[model samples]
Target: MTRHTVNASILLTDRPLLERPAAARAAGFDAVEFWWPWPQTATPSADQVDAFVAAIEDAGVQLTGLNFFAGDMPAGERGIVNNPARQDEFRANVDLVVEIGERLGCKHFNALYGLHADGIDEEAEAEAARANLSYAAKAVDAIGGTVLLEPVSGAEAYPLKKAADALAVIDSVGAGNIRLLADFYHLAVNGDDVAAVIAEHAQDFGHIQIADAPGRGAPGTGDLPLDTWIKAAQDGGYDGPIGLEYIAGEGDPFAWVQA
Candidate 1:
């Protein structure tokens, strides 16, 4: 009875970005989520955004979550909205991200707190992140949407490596719409107590995403108790769709969902 959402950015890697919506539908997913589709932090043109939106609509799938501009994801760029120098890029993309959400009825927006640039100390970058995140919260709130903060694992430079870390930032943002994104894969990869965190913070969780630990592969492919923790979240009151954000390693991504 659990509902699942596929992350098009991670699933269907063989297809073009926009085309992944149909691929998700073919895989039996009715809702999908994605990171920023642009390869760089630069703002994508309106035409490109439109095409992406149209692709989702034509595929008849719902967009459940989206990330603000994260630079070069494959090359290890996290998110740039926290960088003072990159504020313009983040601000520009906010409108675009929100606009697409408006069209698709998507309410979740993720803000990646990018690592610091050379000579930019941690304290300074954290300040910039706080300011930019507040700005983003207000912008998304205008359209009746919620802003999500996630903790990414294996990327030491990214800073938000634990649920507590992300929750701290959410507190600083101080907006009613701001909430934590509890991504189980990242939490386990970083060695956090997954069930304990979910049990404690389920109500504050605006979104949930999962993949197995140690390999970032499918559920049965790793050692984590994906089901136990998922049930824990639901029992604790997290009714949001759990996104299947994992690497497809030679198997159908929907197999776990079907089971």
Candidate 2:
């Protein structure tokens, strides 16, 4: 049977941030993942981290994946890894992310590459990203974790919109722990042939997130063949949990999964 992990950040928005893990458990999922919870500051207070840890522990859910601190996601910032000014800020969060992972036994972390910033040359941005990714890789290595690079859609200025695009950066990083995050919704939104991508690069993926295309809703809400695509990923050797990162809208978000 296929295992699923809820994206607590997006899925259980009706509840408090610390309460989402329990909500996911109540929805019948045993595992969960999240984007950086503290969007405004990379370094959240010790009490804040403790509460997050307690939430997951109290919920009895496994934290399957996490994103390192990206900038204010609500404000449209994708990440800080590639920004020259925020390089230090990105670096500062690496250890904290790793510390959380160590406490939670979570091994997968996503690192979002920011859009091209003004006044910074392309070379400088690329260099900073590579250096930071390498640093994150090294830190996570201590905990035997993997750093994930995902291709996003809807943000035209945000680079790495394809599997190959992220793979090239992984190559440059040259860390075995660095791998691709195959978010099917984003890939399909960006006009990628999802089936072909699954067939050709399933082995390259470290994690998989899903939502239907066009609507970014539950699997049945759109035209994408999510079942077939998931089967393809499985056939191609993807053994990880599937992340439910969709917009639930009004009705039951997990109704499809239950059915």
What TM-score does each of the candidates earn?
Answer: 0.96, 0.98
State which candidate has the highest lDDT: 2
Q: List runs of model 1 lying over 4 Å from the truth.
A: none
lDDT of candidates 1 onward, in order: 0.86, 0.93
* TM-score of candidate 2 on Cα atoms, chains taken together: 0.98
Cα RMSD to the true fold for all candidates: 1.2, 0.8
Runs of candidate 2 exceeding 4 Å displacement: none
lDDT of 2 at 227: 92
